[model samples]
Target chain A: MGRRNDHSRQEIREMALQVAEKIVAKEGLQGLNARKIASAIGYSVGSLYIVFENLDDLILQVNARSLDQLYTVISKTEQQCRQPDACLLALGQAYLEFAMEQPQRWRTVFEYQRTKDAEIPSWYRKKIFRLFKLVEKPLLEFMPTLEPHLCAQTARALWGGVHGICILALTGRLEIVGADSVQNLMELLITNYLAGLKNVQGTPCTPEEGTTQECKA
Target chain B: MGRRNDHSRQEIREMALQVAEKIVAKEGLQGLNARKIASAIGYSVGSLYIVFENLDDLILQVNARSLDQLYTVISKTEQQCRQPDACLLALGQAYLEFAMEQPQRWRTVFEYQRTKDAEIPSWYRKKIFRLFKLVEKPLLEFMPTLEPHLCAQTARALWGGVHGICILALTGRLEIVGADSVQNLMELLITNYLAGLKNVQGTPCTPEEGTTQECKA
Candidate 1:
């Protein structure tokens, strides 16, 4: 958008993010740095600071993009499957595939460190919850009588588990659990957890007690 | 074990591990290194190499010790709980407690990168499997008719998910899912997943079909 010889502020921001993503992809989080990104994008480190508050700020922006990309992948998965149960399975599978394809981008989203009090930005948090809705959507469709809060909690628990499987699978530690395929392990979780939810569906949980273990009561 | 003037090879190795653990605890995995360990333990960096092969080997040793501590914590929890379901909850709680207490050590186990060709040593891996067995025992106890293979797969799926929740919880990202307590999410997963298993127990899964998504069939 700037003159042919010069990148505008917005152009510099995009260039910096692209370079940062490449550094993370090639070297993992430990290898990412302000100098490398600035050098890659043909800018001074001071220019990077002008665009990003700090390295942490840059990582956050990159993570926001990754989460959006993840949501797109899961949304497409959700659209293709007609049955709710199949949709959940397909979502988990899509999640694994996304992690496999973009392992570094996926890793840094969760692994980056924040200063002790640095709060996650609200808009970024929204992208994550939006993805959760992908899981919650199929979940609610499968069990219409389920309460909204429990549906949210269940989405977190199930997706959290699916997330754990992906971590191990990506790190080559899935073998520690003696499982071969991330898909089988994921399917086992979705199918079994769903069957379990149905068994407990007869007992409705009140809002006050929904967060407790006795919700099963 | 060594004379007052000098440490034995084994003593130096232990001292290096302790120093490494301390560095990791205070500054995380990035701060850990042979020079730091050598300085803290009062040995030259060359002495560290003489005692251990490399920093990777040192991390594996430290991780082995962390896994052992994890096993000890979980084993004590397993011993106190009288019922299978209770044991699972207590184990999940114990895991959270351990991670909360030793955040860096627990994190480095899964987060460390070995060289692409580096294989996890068998003995180090055994400690991981040993922890898995603690989960498997209660799973088998909860359902006697469940086949060994399915039980193992279920344990991995369940524990892997729990691990995921723990990672999010420690990193302060657990709030992203709108869940307040890791314990509640962990319980929801275990209880719901077990109840689901109970629903499907009548449908025996032969080993041939166990790993497939069609296991539900």
Candidate 2:
């Protein structure tokens, strides 16, 4: 009976996470609740707490799994690219793709405030930092001349840039600007950001100023 | 009596928004509710719906107000910057500053998605487009040779990049990278993105490989 209960506990945890994702995806974060989750699984409210300490714990677990999936995408994309620069761009693309494909999960991760409090859970921070380190590798290769501090600063800016595009695109805010494809928008951003890095060393180089060529995909 | 009811309705709406903002700032988006809002303002629950049809309407109004305030900051910053490029960078700084200055309002605007609708509110769309046109002016000035479509694309990318940085910085995600100031991060992103725009018509650019010179602020 104890073994059976243990198996059931894992099942319950998985079940709760699946339901949470559905609610978050379909109904936004506002729809999440213990009772709603319980009804979805046809279990009593108390049963959920037995496996998960509280709603916060369950959410942390759900996000942990979701972030792990994000890590996989980043790693796979990074590993697949042969050239270092291409690898960096691919990494940015993958980051944006994840958000576009999975808007619900992406929004939840951004919306939740993961603080230092014990009640907030540490897995959230762990998953997030791991994702950052993923991009940092490609960034280091992409800009070998940058100091450690500047590299960090530049990486944060890159991440911010990619994230900004992804969120706006995911939320349909890009419609205000008349974008045909999210990919094209991001390509421009990454390309422009990379070109700017060339100017960072105080050189009078013009990526676009000297060339009369037109920008195409 | 009708006039008195109208006055009370407006006052109640204002009071509810204050409470909602306070709760969101203190506890995150999940803490928002009609019950808590009513309690915070020393009113009955029904009093809230008298002004707002439901919680969604209340949140919509709150976010609308938040957006107006954000646009005001952007306009004020633009007035001070004489150069188009400087004004664009200043706009980016203003965005980050708004996030830091009013963390709760920022979160509400980004984090709160409508439950039943994937489409953004019409008024919200209009406000966002107005903001986009602001970026267009500097972009056209900086890239005199680009066609209208490409220039619009560049503005969208810049907007996304700036928004992404603001979301990350406000949530303390940038702290992990040891990035000291949001302004530095914005400057780095804006400068890089602009370089790409200037030359994106040329051969595709790689960020780290380009000739970036540090400019004196």
The model with the greatest TM-score is 1
Q: Alpha-carbon error at A51 in model 2, in Å?
A: 7.1
Q: What is the DockQ of each candidate?
A: 0.56, 0.34
lDDT tens digits, residues A48-133, model 1? 89988988889898888888888887789756778787888888889999999999889888888776777888898888888888
lDDT by residue (B81-137, candidate 1, tens digit) is 777878888888899899999998888888788866778888987888899899999
Query: iRMS for model 2?
Result: 6.3
Model 2, retained fraction of real contacts? 0.65
Global lDDT of each candidate: 0.82, 0.73
**Full-model lDDT, candidate 1:** 0.82
Q: Show the lowest summed lDDT stretch of 10 residues, model 1 chain B.
A: B208-217
Best by lDDT: 1
User: Model 2: per-residue lDDT, tens digit, B1-217?
Assistant: 1232454777878878887877776776777889998877777788778888788888877777788888888878767777677778778877778888888778778767687654566887777677777888888888787677777777887788888888877776676445667767777788777765555555543355332111100
